[model samples]
Target: MIVPIPPGERTYRAQQAFEFAGSDLAGLVLFDDQLIQYFTGFIFIPTERPIALIITREGERILFVPRLEYEHALETAQVEEVRSYPEFPGEQHPLLFLSEHLQQLGLRRGLIGVDHDGYPPVMGYSGPALSELFAIRRVSAALDRQMALKSEPELSLIRESARWAGHAHRLLQQYTRPGLSESEVEARATREATQAMQAEMGPGFRSHNRWISGAVALYRGQIGPNSALPHAISINAVFKAGDNLVTGASAGVWGYLSELERTMFVGEPTPQQRHYFRHMLELQDLALEHMRPGRACADVDRVVRAYYEREGLLPYWRHHVGHSLGQRIHESPFLDIGEQAVLEPGMVFSIEPGLYVPGLGGFRHSDTVLITSRGAELLTHYPRELEALIIPA
Candidate 1:
C-alpha cells in the first residue's frame, strides 16, 4: 500500500531548513517543475510558459502561473495565493508581473533564495534573468540534499511503484516470443499491468504522466545487437530466436517511481551470453554489497570499477554503477567517480552495472534499492537469474 506525504510537510521542512541554514534568506522562489511540485503538490504540464512558487520566510505560500493554469492551480496548489500572467511572451512579459508581485511582497531588495537565476528557456522561451529584476541566491543544492533523503511516506510510494513494475516485467517475459515485434509485446504487457494496477489501487490512484504513463515496461529498442547501446531508440523490428534483449520497467505511484530492468533471450542463450550475464550479476552484487550508510557515493563506483578492472571487463563498462532516484527518474548523489555525496539511510537508488559486448548484446539488470542502516534493501522484486529470464524458442 502507498502512503501519501502529509500535505504541507515538504514546504514546512524546506522553511525549517532555510531558517537553520542562517543564509538570511527572505524566502524561496522556485521555477523548476520538480522543485515546485516538491514544495507544493500542484502538478502541471511545464511548457514555454513560466511558472513560479514563492515561499516566504513567514511560510506564506504564493504561486504564479499562466492564465490557462490559473483555475487548475487554485484547485490543486497548496498555496495561500494563486496569481496568473496573461500569457507567455506577452506585451508585459510574465517576469514583469512576477517582479511586481515580488516587490509587493517586499522581497525585491532582500536576498531571496531561488532554484534558477531565470526561467529556463524551455520550448523556445526567452525571458529576463530573475537577477535583472531583484536580488536572488542560488539555493538549489539545499533542496537537492533534502530530496536525496526520502521520507518514509515517499519510500512507501516508491515501494508501491516497484511492486507494479515487477508485475509489468513478468508480463513482458510471458508475452514475448521469437516472432513478435518489441512494440506489440511491450504495449500488451503495459496495458494489462495498468489495468490490473487501476483495479487494485482503486479510484483515488492517479497516474504521474512522465516517461510512460501509469505502470509500463519497455525495451527502448534494446533488442539483439541493439541492446549493446545502453540508451537505444526503438528499431521497431521483430524479435528473432537467439537474440538477446534488455528491458526497462517502471510504474509511477503518484510522482514517485521505481526502475526494474533485465536481460533476457528469445531462445537459449549461447555459452558466451551466459558467461557475460553471470559476470554482470556478480558486478551488481558487488555494487550492492558496497552500498551502505556513511559510504561516499564515489566509493561504490570505485569498487565496481576495480572488479571490472581485475576481470579485464573495463572495456565493456559504459556507465556508473547507479544513481539516486525519486520524484525524478535520476536525482542527486549519483554513484560516480567524482561524486562526493555520502549514502544516507533513507536514500533510494537504481543499482545497475551494465556490460556491452559488440555483436553479442548487453548484459545488464537494474533494480531499485533503498539504503538502510544495516545496508541496502531491494525495492524491486523480479527474478534476476538467467534461466528464469530465458524464453522458449
Candidate 2:
C-alpha cells in the first residue's frame, strides 16, 4: 500500500483552499487531475472520462470518479467516502451525483468556489450549469497561488527528482561519443537513470508511481544546427569533431520533475563557440546570483536581458531565464519580464539561460533550483565548465 499523506496535512490544504476560496464560498469543486491528486494522493492518468472531487468548507470530501476507477480510488484515497458514475455519457449526469452529494451536505444554496480552468470540456460534461444550483466564482488563480508554495514533502520529491536527473546526465555523458547517435545516448541515459532511481528510491518509494518511468522526460542531446534551434528534436545528428552539442534532460520521480542541461563540444570548440559558451554560463550565474527571497522574479530576467542587449546579443535570446517547476513541469511565477511576483522561500525554479545562434549551435545550460532566504540553492549540480563538458573523441 502507498504511504498516504497525513490526515492533518490534507485537512490543512482543504482549510487553506477554503481560505483562498473565501469563507462565503459554500464549497470548492476540483476536477483537474493534478489538483485531485494533491488533495487525495490518488494518481490517475486523466482521460476524456471525467473525475471530480467535491470538497465543502466543513472539511467534507466526496471523491466522484468513473465506476471503473472506483476500486483504485478506494485503494488510494484517504477520504472514507468514495463515489463514482457508470462512465462517460452515462444514464445519469455526473453533476446530478454532485448535486445529490451537495444537497446531502446541506449546501443546497450558496456561493461555490471552482477552478474554471480545471473543469472538463463542456462537450464532455453536458450537465446543467452548476451555476444554476449555486452561484459560481472562478477561483483558478487562488488555486494556483495555493499550490505555488512548495511543501516539505513536495520539496523532497523535487530534490530527489533532481538527483535522479543529475545521475542521468552522468550516464548520458558516459554514452556520448563521436559515432553514437543522439537517440542512442538518450536511451542509454534514460534506462540507466530509471534503474538507478528505482533501486535507490525502492519499490514503496514511489511518489507518483507513474508508468512513464522516473526519467519520464528523459535525457536528450542535440548536435550542431539542431542545438541552435533551442527546442528542436534531434535529427539523429552524428557527433562530429569540434561540433557543439546541447545535452539536456529532465527526470520525473513520481510526478515531480527537474531539468539539467549542459553545452559541450565533441572535442575542441571554435573560438566563436567557446566565447558564446562562456557567456551562457555567466548569464546563468547572473540569474542565480539575483535569486533571493524578496527579489522580484522579473528583475532577474531584466538584469540578464540587459546584459544581452548591451552586448548586442539580444537577437540570439530565445526565452526567459527560467520558470517555476513542480509536478506540472511549468508553473507560474516565471522568471520573465512580465512576472512581478516576489521570490519566496520554498518556491522552486529552473535557471536556464541560453544563447542560441543559428549556424553557430546553441550555447545553453539549465538547472533546477530552490529559492532560499539567503539566495538560490542549486539542485542540479554537474560540471558547468566548458573544458569539463568536452567529450574527448
- Candidate with top lDDT is 1
Any runs in candidate 1 off by more than 4 Å, and if so which?
1-3, 17-22
lDDT of 2 at 305: 99
Q: Estimate each model's TM-score.
A: 0.97, 0.92
In terms of TM-score, which candidate is strongest? 1
Q: Which stretches in model 2 have alpha-carbon errors above 4 Å? A: 1-7, 122-129, 207-212, 216-221
lDDT of 1 by residue, 1-393 (tens): 564567768667656657533469877888989888787788887899999988888778899999999999999887789999999898899999999998899887788888899899899999999888888888887778888888888998899999999999999999998889989999999999999998998888886536547899889999999999999999886999989899999998888899999999988899999999999999999999988899999999999999999999998999999989988899887999999899999999999999999998999999999999999999999999989999998
Per-residue error for 95 in candidate 1, Å, reads 0.9
Candidate 2, residues 1-393, lDDT tens digits: the string is 223346667667876788766889888887877777777777887775678788888777779888899999999886658988887767777677777877887776777787753346745455566776667888876777677788877787777777777788888887888887777778878887888777776777664744335663232445876788877765876777878888776666655777788888888888899889889988999898899998999899999999999888898999999988787767777999999788999889989889988877888898988987788899887899987898898
lDDT of each: 0.89, 0.78
Write down the lDDT that model 1 would get: 0.89
Error of 1 at 77 (Å): 0.9
Pairs in steric clash, model 1: none
How many Å off is the CA of 168 in candidate 2? Answer: 0.8
